[model samples]
Target: MTPGALAEGRPEARGPRFRVVVETGPDARQEIPLEGTLLVGTQVEGGLRLSDPTVSRVHLELQARPEGVRVRDVGSRNGTWSLGVRIHEVTLAGEARFTLGKTTLLVMPEPTEEAAEPAPRTTFGRALGQSAAMQKLFGVLERTARSSFSVLLLGETGTGKELLAEAIHRASPRSNQPFVIVDCGAVVPSLIESELFGHAKGAFTGAHADRRGHLVQADGGTVFLDEVGELPLELQPKLLRVLESGTVRRVGDNAAKDVDVRVVAATHRDLKAEVAAGRFRADLYYRLAVVPVRVPALRERAEDIPLLARHLFQQAGQPDFPLTEELVQRLMGYDWPGNVRELRNFVHRVLAAGDAELPDTRPVSAVTAAEDLSGLTFKEAKERMVEAFTREYLTALLARCGNNISEVARTAGLARSHVHGLLNRYGLKAGD
Candidate 1:
């Protein structure tokens, strides 16, 4: 039986500051208040008693604090794991996923009275969100789409800036016209000028024929410059001239051709700092950022994770896949540093595994190739993925910390002994 909503306290005292959500097992979906030290296990005296066989009589203890919740494993035979790492005790300052035996528990701050009610999921073009951040962003996008201002989409990588750019173009007057994408970072530096502006025949070795650059190609439409911060410093003036004059001068050509194109640039870099560091031009930055809009990161809009996860799984051709409440709770607990793209990949990975319910903690680079999963059991594949991620993450961290074991442990939020144990388990040396 799960404890009641309010913990035993003075009659006039406010409600508990936190709640423990039982995500899986016999007590699945039960929300228990955390007034003080709450015991969880199979015992009848436990505040969160369960019928799950794997849970010990007195498995875990949780205490709620103003800052967060303190969780401790109380001599449980199977131990407890957060995300994917086993833990004896941890102070979780935010939403966290904990697994004991076959059961998953979510410890998080109690939702405010107003927040207890659900908000409708909102969609703008191909993007979907329901959080306040996204709602504000949608309003901004709606306003920006009505005008022809050179929009600058600012956000961390994988926050769907390009999708928003396309949304702007589709909603703008130039819907029928070409919407070109120019990946500034993907293009070769030497050819970028020729690529963006046009080149005449015999302009250079590769100019056997006249070529209209991306600006000309996108005339009467819009051009989305992904990673615009990667634009070469030498060509900044030329780009500025085009934006100001509405004309582009082909590389090695004296004449400038008229081009009526709107520009939408996106980047993860702070252009103002780039300008101060003399890496990017101040004038160009000002010109391109005529109307700046920021796409909120996934963690900033965690309320949308369950909606997004379900949508992503459906998009990956698993429309019938059961996204249990437990699965959604786990998904929301993760801080998706890689944002929506990472979440999409995780959905596909879960679809591939068929029975995976936990969030994939492995970095994007460590996600095993689909081809590699063939003929391998889920356990084997998961082991391989974990090993790859452990090596890659530790290797990067070790290099970043200059082979200092203490520094590595501190950076990774692990004890020195645990870090050493991992290094030893993987045959890695601090110096190596």
Candidate 2:
């Protein structure tokens, strides 16, 4: 049977709502809202049933508990694994990852509405946003910066996670102290250990003299671990130890010295899935994700696009560039898969082209749409036309309803699931 949504008689409400993300294997990229007790296997009657032969007929079970979700393996041919270790049962209070057969599943508590808070200022530190999502995030950041907890910034590429991390540091009490950034993905793996924990003289061929690592350099301050998911698996333990003990031991030296450092890690990867797949250490994941915050994708807050575009133009020294209503509409209609970075590149391209022949920013006219369909097979042309029409219709519908998915679904006479599928396919995100 094809994978689809499962409906179960509601049990007494227990714990917050949760969703399961199928990261790999069969049904990969599918998200299912989980409620009550969920029975997942290859041959289950109602709950999630996979088509993969590797998945046992009765592989695993998940029951929602008042505290959290309790997951158990029910004696399948292949056992269930969490944190790279086989387990009979485990209770996850927040976010957790586990694997059954060849599939990886990540269970996370669905976002809940919080109490009303103060209105968000249009600008927070270096970041800019006026959307409700941004305002809510600003409130969260305000609270996060007041403390010394290790923060994990999760988001898609080009969503300005690094900027948000720096903003948190600047707003925190550690503003006067050093704020060092360690590009975990850019660092040489062989030298990563020494680079993060410092190295003693003669520790390696390149160690001519003692050097302070990122942790030491940012003593009494904050260290932003950019692209932290790329950190080598072998080095995770050492980093965990530092976070736990507040001390670092230099390479080639036995002595350990104390350092006061706050950690703010940012990553575009699903670290939980990485842990469940054995590519990342579980202990370290817990240590870094003490307070996880997801940075909103650009499409999730399209109203900010015009504001961001003007900011970019001013930054590029092209403040005179005309940002007409048509241009704004065209910009807002795009999916912007690359987020802010893509928008910035687009502004630069327009600047480079010069105003003598400014690029067209108006909506696609019927004549232009027909021209775009030229030189294609009938089937291909039909598909292209359908895609374009669907995109335009959805874009206008979203604007009319203020980015409310439920309203859009009702207005279009489509199921919520169908609407959600369309949104994801078109790279659109409903407002929070």
Candidate 3:
């Protein structure tokens, strides 16, 4: 074998012996693929089954090593002493000593003998973060998860409303029961009623045999209706009847069958507006929204973008990739108008089209999406930066128009009252 070759027998080659030891507990064991500064894993009984890439600056120091791998002591409570001496955390290697509380064990390159095989596939545990808005939404979800009341999830298309519905179903008592999804938007208006309420034999042109609808199939479980707002106004009454009473009549059948099913309806439409405009039935809106939830758009919680991106990236089955700080910053700062689905499509595109560096281009229009204001301190520059952005936006819109406050407000997409408030807050006159 030649020098610098992957073969171990080569002159300048090193074998895959890198390892890590986290002193968590007796049942402590975690494997994080060498990728970024933060390690991802689950929190078990004793401690977290996780490792940190940023355990020590010395780990970064070792980046210059010819082997492209290094170990260091990270400041940990239990301490990570590699080969003796009281130290913080240590970057480890194959066959290293691990200590949790008082117990000590060895970490080897070969897989350890264990009976607990991991789950076959990665499940999106749920979006987790500390934003207050998200906390409020979760609080609502927790409060309404069990009761049989139908949930109306309001959010733009691609905002993961269906995913949220699935989470609700999984958390409910009927979790073991079927979780049937019906895309109301995708169903043809003519077939929606038959599709949802089922059909008897010889009911219509396409119906030769009797068949149960999604609501019946979801009996004892959840029937998630995506794009509930798209249901035809005329068909709303029948849906309201099903929600009002736990009974559905198949097409061409005069008799109604009783069923026990939870309804979780989601849509991007402003249902209240639809009700006022007489496009949607108020009775049905009230039925679906026993407890309504508004899923915030991606741009609203920019703080969670990096966490979400890494999670989605891992879900794409790529164990490791250089999703650098700059790239994450760019993503966080960009306006994700397309929301979670757009982000997923984006990662798919990245995995398919580009390399780790990922050329200076974006999947969608290059709008100033999410601004990376994460690193700003709580005081000083952060406030100033925010003020600057707000002030400039208002000023630009005002200047574009001939000092017409109403026109400026319309063009800037601000409410008239909000525009007036901004004008007073910034101490700006009409022409000034």
Better of 2 and 3 by lDDT: 2
Model 2: which ten-residue window has the lowest total lDDT? 1-10
How many pairs in model 3 have backbone atoms within 3 A of each other, for residues 3 or more apart or on separate chains, i.e. clashes?
A: 11
By summed lDDT, which 10 consecutive residues of candidate 3 come out lowest?
A: 110-119
lDDT, residue 405, model 1: 78
Give the C-alpha lDDT of model 2. 0.77
- Tens-place lDDT digits, model 2, residues 1-432: 000000111222234466776767878766675767888899998888787678899898987655768898988888889878997988876556788889988776543323224345977788899998888777767666767767788887778888899898998999999999998876778999998999999998989999998999999999999889888898887897798678999999999999999999988788889888988976676557756778888889999999999999999997877899998898888776557876776777678864322223335455246565678899998887788668767765564444556657755768779999998999877631
Q: Give the number of the best model, judged by TM-score.
A: 2
Model 2 residue 314 lDDT score:
97
Model 2, position 202, has a per-residue lDDT of: 98
User: What is the lDDT for 430 in model 2?
Assistant: 61
State how far residue 286 of model 1 sits from its true place (Å): 0.7
